[model samples]
Target: MLNIVLFGPPGAGKGTQSQKLIDTYSLIHLSTGDLLRSEIAAGTELGLRAKTLMDQGILVPDEVVIGMIDTKLKENRNAAGFIFDGFPRTVKQAESLDSLLDQNNTAISGMIALEVNEEELTKRLLLRGQTSGRPDDQNEELVRKRVQEYNTKTAPVAGYYANQGKYHAINGIGEIEEIFTEICEIIDSYATQLNA
Candidate 1:
């Protein structure tokens, strides 16, 4: 399997690139945010628990996310690979993910990181918030906070993957297609080497 961890801060275009990678490479897109939203929409028990925390501006526990991911993995057991987005934000989460994958006899192929400036990200998100209607995106203060949280809490995830020689950085300040092409090149090269 060609599992990948798509790493980036908020508004780093991870959603855009993950979609392209899924379409082009036939990898399952496992977006934790989307999964949680689905669960909440469906009104599942876990979703209710998560919703309560989310309503109070608190994050749902990591184990809840891991369980959801575990279910996703089980459902896509025969998948070519999975492109993990909005997940493994902490080193602990990364370690748990590795352990989960190890139990399934597979491992993360690589962590594809998108490098974008905070200022640019804030601009993009503010523009998006105009139509996105997400409060976090609408408020510059919130957006900056989110970015700061990612840098402080989630940035170490890249180091974890780097230690395993499974981290690749791509410049995210270009045309969408241009960025996608670069990401594909990295993934394809890794796939080739893995098979060799």
Candidate 2:
């Protein structure tokens, strides 16, 4: 399977590029945020637990997230591949994901991170805030804090993937098509290597 982890900070155009990648690659998009919402909407046992925690302003445990991911994998067993977005935020979570994928006889092909400058990210987020109606995106300080939080917490996840030789960084400041081309090139290279 051509599983990919689409990594990027807030306002890095991950949402835009993720849609294009899904169309071009025919990969199931497994976004954790979406998964959580779906699970809650379904009112599964795990979902109840997660909802309770969320309602109490506490983070849902990793195992809960992993369980949701496991369910998704089973549901999409016939999928060509998966594109993971906004997940595996820490090294421990990354390791857990690797173990889970291994159990399914699949592995992450690579993580493609969109590299964007802080200034550009803030600009894009503020512009999006004008329309997105997301409070965090509307505030410059919140946007910067989110970006810095990603850097602080998720940078090590990048390093973990780097050690496994499954990290790919691409410039995210160009035209959308251009950026997508760069990402595709990286993904295609991995595809070629895997099939070889």
Candidate 3:
């Protein structure tokens, strides 16, 4: 399997690039946010739990998120691979993900990080906010805080992948196609190594 963790902060073009990667690589996109929403939409047990927490303004526990992922993994057992987006926000979650994947006899090929500076991310998010209608995206301060929070929380997840030699960083300041090309090169390299 060619599982990948698509890592980036808000407005880093992860959504855009992951879609392209999915098209190019035929990988299932396993976004936690999307997963939660779907589970809620389906009104499953996990979804009800997640919805309750969300309604109460509390973060759903990692175990719940992992259970959702586990269900998705089983549902898509015959998938070519999966591209994980917006997940493993902490080292503990990263470890949990690793253990879960190990139990399923597959592993993440690598984490592809989109490296964008704060200024650009803020600008992009602010621009997106004008039309996106997300209250957090509309505020410059909130955007910065979100990015900072992402760095503070997710940097160690990057380190976890780095320690495992599965971290790949690419410059995120460029045309969409160009950035995606760079990401593809990294993924292709890992795929080659895996096949070899």
Candidate closest to the true structure, highest TM-score: 1
Each model's lDDT comes to 0.90, 0.86, 0.88
lDDT tens digits by residue: candidate 3, 4-30: 999988888888998999999999999
User: Where does candidate 1 stray beyond 4 Å?
Assistant: 55-57
**Against the hidden true structure, what lDDT does model 2 obtain?**
0.86
Please give, for residues 1-196, the per-residue lDDT of candidate 2 as tens digits: 8999999887888889999999999999988867776777899887788777654434468887888799889998889899988888888889999999999989999999999989999999999999976555788877787788788887889999999999998988889999999999998998898899
Provide TM-scores for the models. Answer: 0.94, 0.87, 0.89
Q: Which digits, one per residue and each the tens of the lDDT, describe model 1 over residues 1-196?
A: 9999999988999999999899998999999888888888899998898777755545578899998899889998999999999899999999999999999889999999999999999999999999986666788877887788889889999999999999999898999999999998999998997899
Between candidates 1 and 2, the lDDT winner: 1
Q: Which candidate leads the pack in lDDT?
A: 1
| Alpha-carbon runs more than 4 Å astray in model 3 | 39-59
Clashing residue pairs, backbone N/CA/C < 3 A, model 3: none
Local lDDT at 65 for model 3: 84
Ranking by lDDT: 1, 3, 2
RMSD of each: 1.4, 2.7, 2.5
Ranked candidates, highest TM-score first: 1, 3, 2
